[model samples]
Target chain A: MSQLLRQHIEKITPLTDSEFTYILSHFTPKKYKKHQFLVQEDAPVPNDFFVTKGLLKASYTNLNDGKEHILQFAWEDWWITDYQAYFNETASSLTIDCIEDVEVLCLSLHNREKICAELHKIEHFFRRKSNAGYVALQRRILSLLNSSAEERYHQLLVTYPQLFQRVPKTLIAAYLGVSRETLSRFSK
Target chain B: MSQLLRQHIEKITPLTDSEFTYILSHFTPKKYKKHQFLVQEDAPVPNDFFVTKGLLKASYTNLNDGKEHILQFAWEDWWITDYQAYFNETASSLTIDCIEDVEVLCLSLHNREKICAELHKIEHFFRRKSNAGYVALQRRILSLLNSSAEERYHQLLVTYPQLFQRVPKTLIAAYLGVSRETLSRFSK
Candidate 1:
C-alpha cells in the first residue's frame, strides 16, 4: 500500500525507501461508506485526504437557493479537502462527501508540519502539486468566465472523461456551473 | 531592496544571510512600463516574475470572442505568471500585462530548478507559497459557485482593498466575474 504512494511521490522526486516510509508514518488510513460526509460545511477542517479507492465530492450549499454546487470530484490518486479551512485552520464553508465507498490516506495538519520538518523533499512534492492545483483553478476560472455551458461540458468530457462516467450527471452539471437540464440537453 | 524580499521569505521560513544572498543571486531584475506586456498569449513562458513595485494583470483572451478576462492582479510582494505554461514548459494561453509601471525580480525555470537543488529550504518556501495560493484558489472557486456578484465584490474589497486603487474598475469587475456596468451599479 505504501509502495503505491511511494511510486506516486517518485514520479515527481526520487525518495529513498526510508524517506518514503518516514513520510508514510504520518498518514492514517481511513475508509468511508458511500454518501458519508468526510468533512462538513461550517466545521473545522483538520486534515487532507488522499484517495486510494472510490470517489469523493467537494461541494458548497447555496444559501439563497438551497442547492449544492459541486466544486470538485476526486477519484483514485486525487487529494480532497476544504483547502481554505484546512490551511487557515478556520471553519470550512464547504463539505466533502463520499460519492462511493472510499479508502483514503488522511494526513493531519500537525502531521503535515512534522513531515515538512523531517523530510524536506516532501515539501517540494506538495509544492509542485499545489502549483498544478493553482493552474487548474486558473483554467476553471477562465472557463467559467468565457466558455458556453456546452463548451464547458465538452471541456470536462475531454479533460476528465473518467470523472464524467464515475459521477452522476447532476453533480457533474453543478461542477460545470450548469443546470441538469442543460447538461442533459448538451449530452444529447 | 533585497531586504524587503528577505523579509517576505522570512515570514515563511528562516534563512541565514548567505542563504538569502544565494537565493537573491538566482533572480534577475526587470522593469516594465504601464500597459506593457510581460508575457503574451500562445507564447512560451520561461520565467515567473515577483513584483517588487507597481501592479500587473494576468489575463487570457477568448479565441472565439477576442474578449479578455483578468485572472489575477499582482502588486508589491505578489508573484505573477502563466503557471501552467511555466511549469509544463508549454505555450501559454494567457498574457501578463503591467497595469502600472512595475519593477520585478525575474527567475527563469532553469534558475528556479537550480535554487531548489542547492537550497532545500527554498523549496519549502515555495511550497508554502503554493499552498497558500491553492487555498486562495479554492476560496475563489467557492466564491464563484456560491456567492452573488455583489458578495464576491464585497469579499474582494475586504481581501484586496488596495487593488481597487491600483487596477482599473473594468479589470476588477472581470476578476470578480461581473460586468463593469454591474460593478458600477453595485458600488452606488
Candidate 2:
C-alpha cells in the first residue's frame, strides 16, 4: 500500500527513500467498506484522501429537489475531497462515499502545509496535480456547454471506459445530468 | 501595475522587495485594444496573462454552429490563458480576446517553471492559486449540474454584478449558455 503511494508521488518526481519516508509519516491510513461515506454534507472536512484502492464519488445534493449531482469519481491514485471545505476549514457542501471497499492515505491540512513548506519537490508535485485538475474541470465545463448529452455520454465513455463496468448506469446518468432513459439510448 | 502583481502574490505569501523585483523581471508587460485577439484557436499558446487593467475573456467555439462558449472572464488582478495549451506547450483549443482595452503581464512556461523551481514561495503561491482555481471550477460544475438557467443567471449577477455593467448582455448570455431572448427575459 505504501509502495502504491510512493509510485503515485514518484510519477511527479523521484523521491529518495528517506524523503518518501518522512512524507509518508504525515499521513494516516484508513479503509472503508463499500457504501461508506468518507465525507458528509454539513460535516467538517478535515482531510484530503488519496485513494490507493477501490472507487468513490463526490457529489452535491440540491436542497430543494434533493437531487444528487455527481461532481467526480475517484478510483485508484485519484485524490478526492470537498476541497473548498478542506482548504477553508468549513462545513462540507458535498458528500463523498465509497462505491467499492476503499483504502486511502489521509492528509490533514496542517501536515500538507508543513510538508509543502519543508519539501520544494512535494509542493511542485501538488501544484502540478492541482493544475491538471483545473484543466480537467475546464474540459468538463466545455463538454457540458458545447456538447449534446449524447456527445458527452460518448466522451465520458472514451475518457473513462472502465468506469462503465464498475458504476451503475443510474449514477452514471446522474453524473452526466441526463435521465436514465436518455443515457440508455446513448449507450445503445 | 507591478504593485498590483505584488499585492496579488502577497495575498498568499509575503515577498521581500528584492524577491518581488526578481520575480517581476520574468514577466513582460503588454497592452491590447478592445476586440483584439490575445489567443486564436490552433495558435501556439506561449504565455499566461496576468491582468493589471481592463478585461478579457477566454472561450471555445463549437465547430458545428460556431457558437462561442465563454470559459472565463479576467479583469484586473485576475489571470487568464488557454491553460491546457499554455501548460502543455501546445496549440490553443480556445480563443482569448480583449473585452476592453487591456494591460497584462505575460509569463512564459519556461519562465514560470524556472521561477517556481528557483523560488519556493513563488511555487507555494502558484499551488495555492491553482487549488483555489480547482475549487472555483468545482463550484461551477455543481452550478451547471444543479441550477436552472434562471437560477444561474441570478447567481451570476449577484456574484459578479460588475460583469453586467462592463460586458454586453449578448456576451453575458453566451457566457451563461442561454439564448439572448432568455437572457433578455431574465434581465427584465
Candidate 3:
C-alpha cells in the first residue's frame, strides 16, 4: 500500500528509503466497503484520502432538485478530498463515496503541512502534483464549455478508457453534465 | 512591480529582501495593449505571466464554430498561462489575450522550477496557491454542472463584481456558457 504512495511521490521527486519511511508515518491507512461514504455534506472534512486501491467519487447534490453532480472520480493512486472544507476546516459542501471496495492512506491538513515544512523534496513533490491537477481541471473546464455530448463522451473515452470500462454509464453522464438520454445517444 | 510579486509570495511564505530580489530576477516585465495576444494557439508557450496591471483572458476557440470559450481571467496580482503547453513544453492549445491594457511579469518554466528548487519557502508558497486554485476550479465545476445561467450570473456577480464591471457582457456570456440572449435576459 505504501509502495503506491512512494511511487506516486517519486514520479515528481526521488525519495531516499528513510525519507520515504518518514513520509509514510504521516498517513493512516483505512478501508471502506463499496458504497461507504468518506465525506458527507454538512459534516466536517478532516482528511485527504489517497486511494491505494479501488475507486471512489466526490459529488455535490443540488439542494432543490437533489440531483447529484459528479465533481471528480478517483481510482488507484489518486487523492480525493473536499478541499475547500479540508483547507478551511469547515463543513463539507460535497460528499465522497466509494465506487469499489477501497483502501486509502489518509492525511490531515496538519500532517500534510508538517511533512511539507519538514521535507523540502516533499514540498516540491506536492507543488508539482498541484500544478498538474490545476492543468487537468483547466482542461475539464474547457471541455465543459466547448464540447458537445458526443465530443465529451469521445474525449472521456480517449482520456480515461479505464474509467469507461469500470464506471457505470449513468455516472459518466453525470460527470459530463449531460442527461442520461443524451449520454445514450452519444455512447451508442 | 516586484512589490506585487513579493507581497503575493509573502502571503503564504515571508521572504527576506534578498530572497525576494533573487526570485524577482527570474521574471521579465512586458506590456501589451487591449486585445493583444500574449499566447496564440499552436505556438510554443514559454512563460507564465503574472499580471501587475489590467486584465487578460485565456480561451480556447472551438474549431467547428470558431466560438471562444474563456478558460479563465487574470487581473492584477493573478497568474495566467497555457499551463499544459508551458509545463509540457508543447504548442499552446489555447490563446491568452489582453482584456484591458496590460502589464505582466513573465517567468519561464525553467526559471520557476529553478526558483522552487532553490527556495523551499517559494515551493511551499506555490503549492498553497495551486491548492487554492484547485478548490476554486472545483467550485466552478459544481456551478457549471448544477446551476442555471441566471444562477451562475448571480453567483459570478456576488463572487467577482469587478468582473461584471470590467468585462464585456458578451465575454461574460461566453464564460457562463450561455447564449447572449439568455445573458441579456438575466442582466436586464
Candidate 3 residues A1-188, lDDT tens each? 99999999998889999999999999999999999999999999999999999999999998898889999999999999999999889999999999899999999999999999999999998888888998899888888888876888899898899998889988999888888899988877
User: What lDDT is reached at residue A57 by model 1?
Assistant: 95
Q: For residues B19-109, could you state the per-residue lDDT of candidate 3 as single tens digits?
A: 9889999999999999999999999999999999999999999988989898899999999999999989999999999989999999999
Looking at model 2, the pairs that clash are none
Docking class of 1: medium
lDDT by residue (A67-147, candidate 1, tens digit) is: 898888998888999988898899998889998999999999999978876776877788788888998988888888788
| DockQ value for model 2 | 0.94
lDDT of all predictions: 0.87, 0.95, 0.92
Residue B115, model 1: lDDT of 90
TM-score of each: 0.96, 0.99, 0.98
**B-chain TM-score, candidate 3:** 0.98
- Choose 2 or 3, whichever is better by lDDT: 2
Report the Cα lDDT for residue B70, model 1. 83
Q: For candidate 2, lDDT tens digit of each residue in A101-138?
A: 99999999999999999999999999999999999999
TM-score for candidate 2: 0.99
Score residue A170 of candidate 3 by CA lDDT: 84
lDDT of 1 by residue, B1-188 (tens): 57778888999889988898889999989999998999998899999998999999988887777777888888888899999999999999889998889999999999987897677788888888988988888778778877889988888889888887777888888787678899998789
